[model samples]
Target: MAGEVVGHAAEAAAHGVDLIPVVALLGAAVIGVPLFKRIGLGSVLGYLAAGLLLGPSGIGLINDPESVLTTAELGVVMFLFIIGLEMEPSRLWALRKQIFGLGVLQVAVCGLLLTGMGVLLGFAPAVAFIFGMGFVLTSTAIVMQILGERGELSSESGQRIVSILLLEDLAIVPLLAVVAFLAPSSGDEVGLTARLIGIALPIGAVSLLIFLGQRIMNPFFAVLASSKLREVMTAAALLVVLGAALLFQAVGLSMAMGAFLAGVLLSTSTFRHQLEADVEPFRGILLGLFFLAVGMSLNLTTVAGSWQIIALSVVTYMAVKAAAIYAIARALKASHAEALERAVLMGQGGEFAFVLYTTAASAGIIDGPTNAVFTATVIVSMVLTPFLLIGMRRLMPKPEQSMDGIETVAELHERILVIGFGRFGQIATQTLLGQGHRLSIIDNDTDMIRAAAQFGFKVYYGDGTRLDILRAAGAANVDLVLICVNDKAAATTIAHLFRDEFPLVKVMARAFDRVHAIELIKAGVDYQLREMFESALMFGAQAIRELGATEDEVEQTIEGVRDRDAQRFKLQLMDDLSAVDAARSLLLKNAAEQAREGGVDIEEEAVEEEVAKSTQPVPPA
Candidate 1:
């Protein structure tokens, strides 16, 4: 009776709860990401580990990976969307040769070489052709993240890597068509007209998005903002992405490509920054889940059974691709170190390789066993990328690329260290740069960093709260560090962190409000300016002078206000708010009394006449 009851109860629970995949994925991410990060590996490896552990090869936790893949695919779509937002249309145009010219050369040269090898290994010409196209792709997500992390995304090698990746992304739909043509399929399903329609969908979508994006997004965001709820804003941002995705899928175009077009369209809008902030958290979580799903698809049993063949394939894949990329880089006149470093970064087979394999398998163009082998090779190549990058850094000699390389953060030597390249940080940076002071800007927002780079500011990618990031940005060596992020907690954390680590480097912080200012002051920040404090003070000065005070009196009043605020900040604001408040009250009273005694007074009627005259603009000399 007891055994029967337990079995029944288990069944009921299983039927009641249907979130095994979500729970399992979250569990893996929670367990894996931090551990990998702790051990010096990246979040990508963490996601991979989560997938491997939950996959059939490990515990068989995710028995139905296909369903997970359906969701995980959204990750790539979001990734592309963000990438589109990072580069403007005009900026993308500037790299036309890199995107079209060199891109075609690299793919044709690499694909043909790999195809030759595949044919030699006994694959049919058609099979060899598929392998050539698939293996020609490099891991865009991994390589681009690594490049951005190392602050090399705007460098020479970085530019080359991006151009190729951009071309590969654009090629996916067309390549799928080629694969369809090669496959022995019914004309009804994969006919010439159907292919043309598919091709037309993406082109038409791009044009439509370019035309309609700003008009819809700006007003849409304005309405969302008027609601004054962040959640509403986030939902609308997601609506733009998913709505675009659905539109593209309806027309038989790539969902990812459609979302990317949507993002690019929104990039030109005033709501770009707000939209990025809203979608960013979801994008990150989903992208990692995507990598996790890919990891889970790797069947360890298959890998072990054909270990020898798989190993050889992996080696050949990396070697052949690296050779091709290195040759191309050298032909482009890249220095030896830059060429070799880029080659290692580009050698890994792409995420799209596995995607194409699955697509082919579903279309019956490739058998299950063969697809399994291809999948293993692509995954292993991706897994080896981080280690390969690390090895390259260790082995390759540094290059004489720039005056300071700007390739790595450690080499970033500037007098002014500005943290957070958002709107606030940009104001500080633009001012400092305009004054001819050398500056090193750091921000985790790659989009902001990329945009700033277009205008000649090289911003490093790293979180300001991290000590290592600060050290890498040369905080200790710099004379002043500016904390200009909008997040109050983050601003406070950075201020305290710098005080502990680089106390000698004076910090000037931008506070969100009075409460935030108090927190920053407690963090040992030498100077804290509330974001609107000066503007408010200036407006108050104008109001005071118009209320009958002379210009000299107005100036003195503003000076006293600043002095009083500084005195309040100097107090122990956190532990003794009562004392600080008392001091503030006393200061205000004494200053008011002093002002009443010292300032010149005017009759009320005379003040109104004088104010009307002062409101007029000064005549030009």
Candidate 2:
């Protein structure tokens, strides 16, 4: 009976272990994600917090986190992949001087400086070097995320930091390769030259494979994509990621780097957007899991033992890094406020630090106690980042004069209306303004509104889509409604709301594209301009020059296509069904016939087959 009881107990324990991860993940998403979002903090922090709470140190839901960590590692790889995809090769090359020159200098200077300090603190030279390498890489994930949230991603300072971070990411490969070669498991007598060669050989092989694969992969994907099988396309995407990762591992390089390169190659493909949409859901879920695993890996026991050292290290590292970044920004000619903001945002150690430190420790280059201290310090620094950004914002110098110039009550007309403010919107707004229209423009972006206000234009901050704000903006008496918001969703919502609430008012909207115009038309939008119409006309004029067509002939052809598109547009608007299908069929048929007439022997049937497989009914619009 005792034996029987022991077996049953063992089985129960096994089952409990299996259920822990599921419970931890579910609980974290349920409790943490919403809480973080509600507080206007990013979900990343919530994931990290959830991981820490349910990890071995907290609720002990995850005792052995290795599997989860591996999965999470894939998330990082995918993250980099997507980032690389967004950046074209030309753009990357344009920034090459900064990425390589400034980036290399920053890493070398920071690493050496930090290493020297580590050695002075009594660490061996090897250990100090390892630590320096780990410290040199700032968190690309955190910095990019923060920049994106604040809309500074396109700003000068943000771009510089992004370039630096990209270089650091690249630098990690070499650093890890060196650590791997120097690992105690390897023979002590192995020469540096041979070790370097060992690393180089694998990298070369991987590069060759990627080059060759691209030639084949693109066409293969093109064929599959032409088939229009969602399942097949999704499978192909997964294959690209998993295959590239596995290939990298086989070549002895990091999988993340391989995934990044693969994404770079795919960025050149015409179907990049479609692939992005298909892969986004998978990427998001996997990334969340990856972050959760990172949380689970936090060793509370180690942190507890070296809290003082960890605290001091974090403070010192952040201070030094921030100062270094600030100096770099000034040298790079950034404004003082911009430099300060950049410094604060990039002061923390990042996800790459965790990877580097762990790899170094595993290679026996760093002692266990030192690794624990540094790891904990990195985590602490990350925790402080959000607060640091908040403080930076508060410290920004306030302008002496308010930009709002609503000096007189008469200036605030009861029937306040806004016209276009974008390149598209500006023309319409200017035309109306020249006619002495009493309009108060509404724009969501604070910076844009400020700029316009500086030029003595009256503008207000509000999302035009929101009915409450519109009502507050005097929708009752507003004689005209201008729905010039760039975002399609916002434009649509505003039009619908305006029509329902104030049917008597005229509503003019800017369409995002041809499809957008059709949608607006269906929704009873008064006047709609295709966003690309003007640009297309300009292009047509340029094409006429190259094609040797007379001005009249060129204009006639342009008018023909426009009329056809407009008639199709109207038909689509009226029927409110299968516009995209009719458009694609018409366009593809024309192109196929042209190719065949040119003796190119184009596959019209194949093209149609692919289109039939690939094209989906555009949602509503």
Candidate 3:
């Protein structure tokens, strides 16, 4: 038994952080994350559960989990790096107010309140001071994961959350250093100066890095690409991260900050996509490992022994922190529900607290027993956070599940109306929308309307046959009313209505056949188009070319057929059903004669297709 204990201690020691713990951890994550995910508990909770199972409260797989926790800071760097890759400089500038203003207020208010709580709980003022600062942090990994899972990262509140987290990440260095600087015996002048200088260089290392990268990095990568060795580029990418990390660490900054700056520099680079593809796998695995380390580091034995103290501390800390965040968010004009979510989402002790606690313990700012309690409090808050998130889900407004592909017209500052969002209407709407036209699209399908809402399309559910629907869609203000109703009679009604009610609007209607086109002309639509007319013309032209007609011959034959059919279509519009039949007969005879004159023998079907392509409300002239 003595030998076993000694052997285990040796394995857990600084020189030999055993591989068994790593293997056990990976295995547990492999098994646990999916199980938790299946039950909708989320993957972060699964990692924590695995940790609890392997932690001191259960089987002691790793006696000293804090060591692994310390090593897992790399995962934080990777996480920040990936975040940086997603952000452009303009976006960062846009978030500056959130990062500096709201983030600063959150830290100040929460830290002060937490510090007061610690003091009331009988901690020394200095210890309470650092405690407040450290505990003000919430778990970035967990919060970001939750926000991402719910697709709230792009939401207004979620953007603020990200900005606040960035500020906290930046605050760690100064927060850690400040309390230490206050200690009477501390001789940290050089260290303090180095950190200060690091933060405020003339060009700022971040700017310098970006400037240098824009000039040299592009050409460097280009040269590397010429070698045609992908492995080399990947290696160079890793090296870039490493170099940035070293530079920042030398200046007393977070290594994650360095990685983020490096990522931002590469964000707009031509190789950004490839770099992300390469870095994503590493970021994902390392981030998972980081969370797993947090779980393992939970000293649940201490929590059980001091359950009363642990529970009191967590409750007090979360209450104070949440109250502060909620009040601040509300002041910032976040809605009641939004403020509540931000509060609950951020009501945990951050991963940085462990570093702070460990550092304070080493500096004798906080004793061992106090540090243990505080650490447990931090972990307990984190463990409960998944539950908090689950609860918040009940209040958060459900997002749309599909996209209907309709955009509102007035929003785009241009006016176009699309009636009948069927297959034909949808195609026309999509094309017009692509050209920067603002289109108000109305469809009869409620399911399509709801589904489109998910994709952020604002489509109205209404029948095109209703004048009320047309007025609501602002047909009067529209420059063009694209009528693509699949029904021939319904389409004719809409064309006439637009021509009568909104005469200034361009009325273009899709026709089912030549008969529909003539009816649309009689109804006074400005233009009439057969849906498949151009398609048939192209097909017939291709057939003519394949059948040994030269390009000029095919062009001339198609044009001749178009002219003759246009004349026939005019006759149909001028007369009645009998006149249309007579016009078709004359058109076929003329096309066959023309095809012979051009030495391109035209089939009856080919002549008919050309005639269909040739018909217009009025001849081209």
Candidate 4:
């Protein structure tokens, strides 16, 4: 009877304990995320703060962190997988020189320099090597996220940092293998040759899997996609991830490496976009959880105790790494601004550092106290990255400019005016120019105009919607107004302004759909093109061919569907406009009725009403 009572108490305690952490996590996100956003910092910081607050060192709510750590590992794997999908083989090959050459140089130089410092500071050789490796791998996630947010991901500096990060990730693989071999459990005296062979096997297996698995998986996915079962496809995607992960584990390789290979394989597949759409939410949630786990794992008690040492280490690590990266970037012939940005961006220790340090500690490559110090340093470096980036931005030199013989708009005469210079407008401009038209395009995006100028294209940097700017572009005498802007409301506004201000000009506009085409037609557009209608027809035809339908039958069916939808769309467009007009008329009638009830004679005011209606420009014919 006493034993049964004890068991019941234990069960209740377990249930109560589980609820506390869940509530705390939720509460933190609810309160902290908004607060962080309000303060102009990102939500990632909020999540981290939430984790820290609820962790054992803070509020003491979350006790068992191991489960969260496992999930966080999965998050890292998924993150790498998505990154692999984004990096196509051809693109990877393009960066091969930088990745292998600059990347290898950075890692070797930084690792040796840091290791030498660590050894001099009284660390064991093995411990120093592990520390060096940890410091060598920069935070790909944080750096990339920051660069992407700043819209600098395509900058030369960003590209170099990315290549270096990729190389670091690759380098960590062999480093881990060496650590494993050096561990007591792995038979330390098995010789360097045997250890090297062990490392080569796993790497070779992963390469083979990527080369062969991609060909087989693509067609398999295509078949599954034809079924049109979303749930099944999602299940299939999860299966691929799990299966690849299992294979990696079976071969004693990193699960992330396997998932990455799987992603690369699927990158070339036709269904890549669909797979990304399906897996994106899962990846995001898991990544957030991973970051939270990282926060929870932070031993704030240790940090508080050794504040001075931790602070010095963090500053030293970031300073040394930044200097190294900047020097290497300059050596590679990067511009001064680019070199500075790359150095600052890649100055922090990464998620991989956490993994490497922890694994090395477990393998006895590093002592416990040293491991703790490095871990604290990694966290502090990560926290300081945003501030470092801001400082770099302030310090970097501005680009030089030459003010020599630049032509003003007043000096140019043979100008072909383009109203909108979007994708369609650009095509139209190029096509016309091939036939000897001296075109001068107009667009709102300053970046687009600047880029166009680099390519020797004459583009006017101003909004075409304003009549003054239109006049400035010589709209009265210029050849054409190609209304290629994507926004419907903006397009309509510009069309009205053009018709009212410059009625003699010819106007060709792009329509959103068949209904939009009809609206454009009524708006007195000289020509209208339905953007995606033809593309949709072509897709249907392609589907029919895959489904074993005859070409003629497929063509006829597509044509029939197109004609029917176009007609239906036209009717609907007319009906919608008529309904809107009727509603407006009813509103006016009701107001007039109310006015009459108040003894106002609206019928006698017919002349005033006619004048008001006349002054209001007629709706497009």
Candidate 5:
């Protein structure tokens, strides 16, 4: 009895020990993330700080960071999966040029430069190459997280950066193979069969993954979805992600790469959005943990013991890598601002460095002390990246775009001022021009202005949302202001500004949709027209005429639509009955009815859909 009680107590103690690390990690993340974000250091830094505080170097809440890191790496895998879901195969194909062209160039140039720097720092040639190549693979999690936070992930420049990162991810495979080849030959050198297997295995794993993604995944998801269990769906998502990651890892390929390919395959799946939603929570938590693990993995003892070497290495490596990246970007026609941003983001060695260093150490290519110093240097560099970006933002000058032939908004006496020169503005300008109304045109797009100049349109470069630009464009002197910009928010702001500052000028604005129309009305614009309303009405009228309706019938039908829209608009403005709300309620009713029916007739669903669409407010054009 005594022995059993003692055994039970020991078991309980073990369980408690397991629970404590989880609690500490969560507590640190909860505290660190918010504090860092509030202070403007960013969540990544917050996680790092929290991790460091809990690591062996600090209070020692968690002694083994490597164990945490192994699990936390799943966060990176899921992140890549989510990114893959966003990148449709077609869209990814569209970026093939940038991916292969710019990606290859950046990697080759940065690798060579970093390798040369390593050599200059007195490392042996083979060791220097490993150091350089390891650093060459930038932290995808860090870059992607920052871009996502800034909402630039879908931008053209962002896509270009993503392409470079993709190439870097692919480069890891060959880099690992290089590490193996560079390792000092033991008495028993690797056999030819082993070398061939090493090469063939990764390729086979990738091919198997492709086949599973194309042929099995969607159907597998479909089967799981039919079960109609939310937990089961979530489990399936995890299974797919983990399974793919495991397959690649087993074959010595990148787990993140495997997950990414799986995501790309599922990008066109009907379950794409559902998969994203299911994985998002896990992705966010794990990714944070991953960063925390990275922070904990930082060997402060190692850093402290070899402070000079680590510090010098961090500074020298980061500088050389950043310079190389910046030069490559500039060579690829990136603007100064873009090149600088890329440089700041990609300056540090990533989590992959640890993997490379470990492999090299295991292979006896690098000594333990060298591995420790290099690892410490990488961690220091990662920690400094956020600070470097902050400094760059503060100190970097705003790039001055060439305006050799472009004209700025000047004081003009024209009767009308058109703020935007987009398709809508250009078409509107034609009507006023036909009526012989003198007007001044302004647009924020430099390329558009240049394009317009080719066709003899005197469009000036000016931001419509800026008060100074509006004033310079003679908004106060103009009889009317045309806010024909595509952005709903910008149009509303311009309208509100004119109503307050240029009360004498009648503000006529283009609405993005029904909601925008209401917003413009609240802004007290003298005239507001939904950009697509008139055109859509005309299109429908033409369809009616083609369906054998007489000319008068088509005209009368269009007039009825116009009148009903006006009535709805007025009602929406007065907060009486919202057309949008009414339409939403109708949709909910239809959905509920369909659910109750357990599969409504196809014809009925179509009819209900048409009804919903007709009354449904069109989204922003």
Candidate 6:
């Protein structure tokens, strides 16, 4: 009995020990993320800091960071998968020039420059080449996260950056092959057949993944979805991602690339949205943990022993890489500002350096100590990246709008201040212009302002979201502020700001949709109109007229719609938002029933179509 109790106690203690790391990691993230985000340094830096605290160098809570890093890498795989979902095959094909032309030029140039730098620092040609190539691969996680935060991932420039990153990811496979070729031979050499097999394996794995994905993924998802078990669907999504990732890793391709390819294959699948939603939560958590693991992996002892070497390598490599990137960007016809931005964003050596260095060390290409030092240098460089970006933002001049033919916001004594000069704003201004009411109009788009000037309308260059710009536009003196910006968030912010600070200034805003209109009302705007609402209503009324409805009947039907819409809006304002869902379902059910009575099988034909259409902005009412 005593021996059994001791064994049980020991097992229980082992279980408790296992839970410690999980608790520590979560606690660190919880404490770290919010604090760092609050100060604007970003959550990435926060996770790094927390990881440093929990790491062996700090308090030694988690000694083997490699174990955690291994798991955390899945986060990166999922992140790539999500990115692939956003990139449809057609859109990706559209970016082929940027991906191949620009991406190739940047990587080749940067790799050459960095390799030369490494050799100049007294390393052998092969070793230096390995080091340089590793650094050339930028951290996709860090860059993507920053771009996502800035909401630039969908921007034209952002897509160009993404294209370059994709090329870097592809470069990893060839790079590994190069590493193997460079490794010191141990008498038994790889024959031509072995080399051929080596090449064939990856090709076979990739072909198989494509075949299965194209032929089976959708149908498999369809079957799982029919089970109506949400958890099972989520599990299936994970299984697909991990299975693809493992297959790629086995074939010496990066797991992230494999997951990305799988995502692209499923991009057009009917279940794309569901897969994305299922993976998002896991991606976010694990991605954060990945950063944390990186921080924990930073060996303070290694850095302290070789601080000068690590520091010199970090500075020299980053500077050389940045210079190469800037020069290449300019050569590619990018503007000075864009060149500088791209250089700063991609300057740091990335996570893949560890993988490359470790592999090289195992193959006797570099010593273990050299690997440790280089790894530390990469981590330090990664840590400094956010700071460099923040400093660059502060020092770099904002792209100045040319005031050659455009006026700046100044003390204009107009009674009405128009925040945006877009199509909606231009049309709204026309009514006031016809009445001879002089109005001050401002827009941030230089091209738009210039074009408006061509049309004999003077649009000033200023961002309405800035309080100072608003004041300079005579917003304080204006009796009313007309906010017609197409951006929903910015419009809402402006409306809320005016309602709080310039309370007496009647504000009229343009909304993107019904939800935006409701938000504007809550922001205390005097009036708000969905940009598409009136035009759509007029279009529908015209359609009814074309169907031979009398003018009186058409007018009555329009009035009914208008009244019903007002009632729904009022109910939404009172916070009973569920009414919208209830009303929509009831209407769809009634229509389906009527169709059934009319001898149509609604479920067999129109249910899917109607369900899809119902998700669009609820009809005016």
lDDT for each residue of candidate 1 in 447-562, tens digit (9 for 90 to 100): 66667778877778778888888888888799999999878888999998987988888889999987787777667787888889898999999899789999999999999999
Candidate 4 segments exceeding 4 Å error: 1-19, 34-38, 148-157, 181-200, 394-447, 450-457, 460-621
Give Cα-based local distance difference scores for all models: 0.78, 0.75, 0.79, 0.74, 0.87, 0.89
RMSD of each: 16.4, 19.1, 16.1, 9.0, 15.9, 17.2
Off by over 4 Å in 2: 1-17, 150-155, 180-188, 191-200, 397-621
Query: For this target, which candidate reaches the highest lDDT against the unseen true structure?
Result: 6
| Per-model TM-score on C-alpha atoms | 0.64, 0.65, 0.64, 0.66, 0.70, 0.72
Residue 289 lDDT in model 2?
81
Model 3 residue runs over 4 Å out of place are 1-19, 184-212, 395-621
How far residue 339's Cα lies from its native spot in candidate 1, in Å, is 1.8
Ranking by lDDT: 6, 5, 3, 1, 2, 4
Q: What is candidate 2's lDDT per residue for 185-299, written digit by digit as tens?
A: 7645768898788768786867675685568777888899889799999888878877887887776677777777788788888877776776777777777786677677778
How many residue pairs in model 2 have overlapping backbones? 4
The model with the greater TM-score, 1 or 6, is 6
Taking the tens digit of each residue's C-alpha lDDT, what string does model 3 give over 63-98? 777677666677777777778878888888999988
- Compared with the true structure, the alpha-carbon lDDT of candidate 4 equals 0.74
User: How good is model 6 by TM-score?
Assistant: 0.72
What's model 3's lDDT at 407? 39
Candidate 4 residue lDDT tens string, 1-621: 967865676588787754545656777777887797677666667667777777766776676565786776776677667766777888878889998999999998888877776677667787777877798898766676566567776666667777787788777777887788667675446778987887677877787778656667888888998998999999887777767877776676767767777887788778788778777777766766666676787788789887877777677767787888889888878877778877777887877888788898898777787788898788778767766766656676656443232332332244456766667777767778889878666776656666667878766666777777777778778656788887887787778877788887788888887667766766677777777777778988999899999989998999899789867865776676677666666667677788889998888367347445534533443
Model 5 residue 376 lDDT score: 83
Mind giving the per-residue lDDT tens digits that candidate 6 earns over 1-621? 967865676588787765657888999999998999899899889999999999998898789999999899999999999999888899999999999988888889889998898898888898889888989999999999999989999998899999999999998888888888888888897789988998899999999999998999999999999999999999999998999999999989999999999999999999999999999999999999999999999999999999987888899999999998898889878899989999999999888887899999999999988888878988998999999998999999888766777778777788999988888898999889999999889998888999988888888888888888888888878899899998999999999889777999999999998889988886889888889888999999999999999999999999999999988877676554355555776788788889899998767456656655665543221
